[model samples]
Structures are given as C-alpha cells and as structure tokens.
Target: MSVRTMNRRAVLLAGGASLLLAGCTSTSAPARVALAAAPETPKSPDSVPPHVQAMYAAVMDEPYPIRASRMHLVPERFWRQEVTDPTGEKPGSVVVDTTDRFLYHVRDDGTAMRYGVGIGAAGFEWSGRAHIAYKREWPTWTPPSDMIARHPELERYRHGMEPGPDNPMGPRALYIHQGNVDTLYRIHGNPDETTIGKAVSSGCVRLLPQDVIHLHANVVSGSPLLVV
Candidate 1:
C-alpha cells in the first residue's frame, strides 16, 4: 500500500476508536441534572380561633377596680373550652388531672369547662379527693412554715402577703379542704401565664389570671373537688 494511503487509514482507525470509546463511556456513565432548591416556607405566629379571641377580649377588656397589669401572651392550647366530662363526678364538681395539667369544672349539661393549669413539682404533688372549702378574690398569701424554711427571705411574708398584681395568688383563690379540715392546698391564679401547662409550682394548682377570674366567679363554695 502507498505511504499516504497507510497514513490516511491509520488516522481514520484512530478517529473511529476514539468515537467508540466515547460512546461506551457515555453509555456506562449515569446522567446528572442540576435542580433548583425549594423555597423555605415562612412560619406564622400562633393565633386563637374567633370565638376564643372573643372570649379573651371579653376577659381582658373588663374594667379592673385594682391596678391593672400587662397581660402576658399565652399559648392557644391553654384556652378554656367546654369538653365532654371524663371525670364521672357529679355536676358542679372540680377535677384536677395533674399528669395532664388540666382542671375540669363539671357542668350540669354533661360537659366540663377545661382549664390548663400549672401543677406542683416533684414532692410538692398531691392527689386525693377534696372540696372547695372557700374562695377569695385577690387573696392574701401566708407562706407555709415549710416554704419559709426553704427560703428565709419569705419570712417577711410569713404573716401574710398583701394582695396585688405581683402576689403569687393573682386574681383569685379556691381553698381546698377535706371534711372541714383545711388541706393547705389551693387552686389559684398566677400572673405568669407562661406557667400554665407546666409543673413548676410549690404545691398549689395555678391558672391564668383571666381564667381564674372566670372560674372564681362561677365556682361556688363547698363544690366537690377531685385531684388525680
């Protein structure tokens, strides 16, 4: 064969081998495509339903004879509602479920008014049947001996702490008793709304100030109470 012809054949063979190799590489390799990232969704603030907002407005808008304090924003989950009665107690009875941090006020219509509450922590927890021996609005707070022993600074209030917005017992208090004996435990209001749905109180059950005010107005003395 001629040198030019041999060179042309060699060039053509080299070009064909390169094309074959490229085809094999393309067939074995996986395809890759770039994709746009998804946009992040903005989180919205928590809000209450229209009815609950109305109820909250009614409680907050009411005039207070005493010095009014700023209302703290509470989680919507703690809002009061009339739910089916789970306590099996007679109407007008109060049931406290410490584990769930809920207080149910039994109603005559086979439903209970449920309120979120802050319960006692650890050793401070108590459970048993009791009654609403009495109730008070803006009640005085007398530190129990045990509580005083834990914090000597409370000694000043050992006699009694005057009622005000700063008072631990916020707007109202329900004294619990058993058979005419004072249990020394109480269901009361706390100005700190964030405490609801928590277990951080000394021993007493605490509700939101507005909630306790509503409860105080409705609950009568000698109402049966069950703490479980």
Candidate 2:
C-alpha cells in the first residue's frame, strides 16, 4: 500500500483502539467520532509535491493572510453576482456562481457571506445543486488519472499527495456530493490568491485563503451547495 494509505489505516486503527479502550461503542453520535478523527496538520507549504516544484515555488512565498496578494482588498463585485435559483433557499443554504466566480452562504436574514472563487475550465465545469456531504480541514489531493494523463509531469504522484501548505486544497475542503455520488468537486483553499475571480481550475472550486478560512468556519456538513 502507498504511504498515505498506510498512514490513513494507522489513523483509523489508532482511533479504533482509543474508542475500544474508552468503552464508547456508540456510532449513533458520529460527530464526536469525526472530531476525534480529524487531522491537525495535513500538509506543509514549503515542501513541494512530486513534480509540481515549479508551480509550488510560484506560490510558496508566504502563508495566507500574510501573502501580499491577500491584503490587496478585493471588491465585492468580483464574487457577488446573481444566478438562476428558481428553487429558492431551503432554510440555511449556500450557492456558487461559476460565471461570476462567487460563493454565497445564505443566511436566515436573507443575506449571505459573499466570497470570490476560482472555477473549473470550460469542459470540466459542473452545474446544479449538491449537498456538502463531507468537510475536511486540510484535505489530501490525489490527482485524478485524467489529470496525470493530460499533464504527464504529474503522473509520478498519481496515487495520492500528502496534505500540506503546498497541497492545492489549501487549508480546508468541503466535498460536495449529489445523493450518494461523489461529485469530486470541492470547495477548497488556494495558495494562489491571484486566481481569485478567475476561471481556471480542474473542476474544483478554489478560494483565496482568507475567503476559504471564512467559509470553512461557517460551512457545515449537510449544508446545501448549489453550483451554477
């Protein structure tokens, strides 16, 4: 098995052992278990992934909130634009507009937290509504085989890449799913702040570190995430 897979197994084993020792066999309360299972530090910014050294070097200057680009004060119009939402909000929810590159966390007060995002390329784009089935603080990124096929330079790390500052997912990830199907699209952090309001991703939603940190704090599993 790959190192990452083995690490994941070790984590599961350790968590299971702890649970067994604690005599807490209840699965009805998964939130507690999930909290216990979350990884604290998934990746490091300075360490480059396999063959992505150049791309990583371009973005490995400084951490978020301190990066020069993040402090530039972006306008709201960059991420706040209307879209067709005939179904309306379902109590507390969220919606993302790929055309305008904005994500809205709908509040009960009829307003929302507007944040800019980087969207997928034309052919790799996704539309329609999906639920946030899972959320991770710092997610590991296993480049899809297609991605490696297109960019053979990335083939070396096809299995899975460790989570860290260099990981494209940034500081957090919210996995969207339609029913039981994994959309494979994620609302994740981007170390490249310049990509904000840009349509240049491989099907995943990319957010500047500041915006992602804000979204991560507010979003929860089961939240409705509409991408259109």
Candidate 3:
C-alpha cells in the first residue's frame, strides 16, 4: 500500500467538526486550452458512450442550482469512467495522479472509478499522503488573504463566499489534511468543464460540478487520499 493511500475507513468521519479550510482558490490565469471542445461528448454521436453523456447531464433538483453543461466542450477521456485500478491500493482508497490529472476511487472489485481533475499550476502543486478531514455540500468558500490581494474584487468576500452555483467551491468540497493540520487543499468542483485535465487551480484539485458531486457522495470522509 502506498503511504498516501487512506487505510483507516470512516464516512462522515468528522461529524459536526467545523471545516478548517484555508480556502482553495483559483487564480485568474487561463487554462492551456482556454476553451475546450467536447467534455460531455465524444468526437461524434457514434463515438460517445451513453454513460458519459448521462454523467454530465444537466443536474437539476440539487439544493443549489447547477446549470446543464454544453456537451462537446471537454474531451471524453476526462469524463468519469471505470478502469483498471492502477494504484494497487486497498479497495475504498482514493488516488490522484497529478501528472495525468486523474482521480481514482479504488473499488472492491478489480477496477477503480476514475474522474478527470484540474490540478494546481506548476508552482502551486503539492504531493504526499493525506486524509479527507471532512466534506460538505454547498460548502462556503473563504479566499486566502493573498488570493484576495491579487484579485481585489474578491475583497468583498474576505469573510467568506456564500454557497451557490457560482461559488468557487461549487456544490461540494472534500477537505484534505495531513496529520492534524489542514493542508489548505481540496477536491472541489469548478463550474467550467473546459478546465478538466489541465493544471489550472491554485493548489486544489478541481472537477466538473457533477463529477465532484459524485466523488463526494461515494468517497467516505477520512478516506485516505494519495496525490502523486
């Protein structure tokens, strides 16, 4: 087992424990592929697998509103799918390969559920073993003071950003911590589908809104998360 893989299993693990978030905010830098073409779709109607389209379909009925994404904006490879468990970690653990921008949730079976991710940019990337300290739906966002300095308009939200479709933390966020300290990183949602599989976040892992929602519901709190 990799040191970064979570072994101790617990769901909703830190019940009622207040989220100790340092704010995983994104910078204004544009993605390498500023506008993607084919996120919820494949090259052609014949190319798409029925499951991929359903995964990114408009998510209504959420406590917070989520707009249906335009298909064909992000590439198909980043879409959620099942694949071989390359990490060889215990079932139920989570593994993130930053280099490939893929997050895998190992299953009891011989495969893993993989979702595309937007990782931290060159200088802001981080690695190592961590456990999900907690998770939240419609989580509040508080941008770090430095992030505010760079984007003064964010100053108005210095205290905190409310939960909404527009919130940077999106509808769900998984807080990552090392030992007892907050690593100040998160696996959260981005409204933009084009950013998947690219290094665009400040230091957090970003996923499409629907993708993050699925990951959060399935991955337990306090699950081991390995980022390499």
**Cα lDDT tens digits for candidate 2, 104-192:** 77776556666767776545566666689978876677666566656666655667667666677776788777778776777887756
> Per-candidate TM vs. native?
0.73, 0.65, 0.82
lDDT of 1 by residue, 1-228 (tens): 233543344344334221100000010112222122112222322344556545544344433433221223554446788888776678998877766678989899989898978777555666666689999988888777776666677778778888866677777899887777676787887755546666666668888777888899889999987776
Give residue 146's error in model 2 in angstroms.
Answer: 1.0
Candidate 3 accuracy as lDDT: 0.75
Question: Global lDDT for candidate 1?
Answer: 0.65
Q: Order the candidate numbers by TM-score, best to worst.
A: 3, 1, 2
Error of 3 at 23 (Å): 4.4
Off by over 4 Å in 2: 1-69, 73-76, 79-87
lDDT of 3 at 43: 52
Measured by TM-score, the strongest candidate is 3
Per-model CA lDDT versus the true structure: 0.65, 0.56, 0.75
TM-score of 1: 0.73
lDDT for each residue of candidate 3 in 104-174, tens digit (9 for 90 to 100): 99999889999988877656677767789899999888888877876687888888878887788888999
Better of 1 and 3 by TM-score: 3
State which candidate has the highest lDDT.
3
- True lDDT of residue 192, candidate 1: 56
